[model samples]
Target: MPRLMAFDYGTKRIGIAVTDPLQIIATGLETVHPKDVIDYVKKYLLAEPVERFVVGEPKQMDGTESQSAQHVRGFVTLLKKNFPAIPVDMADERFTSKMASAAMLAGGLKKSDRKNKALVDTVSAVIILQTYMETRKF
Candidate 1:
């Protein structure tokens, strides 16, 4: 079975996570510069069989599309264009960053580590992947 990959796209960096072949567990893969995301995914595809892509969809408190929605939509378009074989899906990501920060605090991470936005992004990607996995009927 092929794995499922998830992305938390941001202006400065993109966080990545992947599910197990059985789609059971979601694990944080890496955080890459926004400009390097395509190359990174290409290299990763050469090594791993990813069947699907999940991207976090940012929305405002009122459940409306946020400013970052356009950026994520563009990123999704690029993914669809580059990896036509893989289907890209979106999941609501209203409080993922806050959740990630809470997780880091609970994990007892150092202050410096907690201050890293990239770390938060990576964790958010993992959360997104896990959320997608749990929602699957099979």
Candidate 2:
């Protein structure tokens, strides 16, 4: 089976995560500049067969679309246009950042390391991928 990839899109950086071939485990891949997303995905596709892309959809507490949603939407459009074979989906990302921070704390990361926004973004991508995997039929 092909793998699934997740992206945590941010203004400055994007965190990436990927599932195993069996789609059982979601692991953090890397944090790359937002501008490099297309190139990164293309390179990844050359290296591994991925079937789907899960992007974190940021929403307000009341479930309204957040400003960042527009940016993600554009990214989704780009994905569809550039890689029509790979489907793109969205998952609610309400508190994934907070959860990532807590995870870092629990993992014994230093305060300085925990402050790294890129690290939190990467962990958030992993959380997003895991959430998608749990809710998926397969």
Candidate 3:
């Protein structure tokens, strides 16, 4: 079965995650620079079948779209234009970074390790994918 892929998009890095073929678990895949993300994804698709994409939708405390959302929208547009078949959905990203940090702490990561922004981004993508999957449970 095709897997579900999720990305935590940032100005510098895009963190990617993928679900198991059974769609039961979400795993961190990679973090790529924004300029290389499309090519990275293209190469990934050549190796694995992805059915849909989940993008983190940045929002403010008042539930309004965050400024960074515009950037995400642009990326989504390019994504659709590049891969017309895969569908893309956005999930609210509030508190994901904090959640990622808390998870890493709970997992016993050292303070220095937990401070790795790239790892945090990847973990945030995993959290996004997991939340999306939970909401869609049958």
**Cα TM-score per model:** 0.97, 0.97, 0.98
TM-score of 1: 0.97
Q: CA shift at 30, candidate 1, in angstroms?
A: 0.7
List, residue by residue over 1-138, the lDDT tens digit for candidate 2.
999999999889999999999999999999999889899999999989999999999999999999999999988898899999999999999999999999999999999999999999999999999999899774
Residue 53 lDDT, candidate 3, scale 0-100 = 94
- Order the numbered candidates by TM-score, best leading: 3, 2, 1
Candidate 1, superposed: residue stretches over 4 Å from native: none
For residue 97, what is the lDDT in candidate 1?
A: 93
- Model 1 residue pairs with clashes: none
Q: Choose 2 or 3, whichever is better by lDDT.
A: 3
Task: Output the TM-score of candidate 3.
Answer: 0.98
Q: For model 2, what is the error of residue 117's alpha carbon versus the real structure, in angstroms, after optimal superposition?
A: 0.7
Residues 24-67 of candidate 3 have per-residue lDDT tens digits of: 99999999999999999999999999999999999999999999
What's the lDDT for candidate 3? 0.95
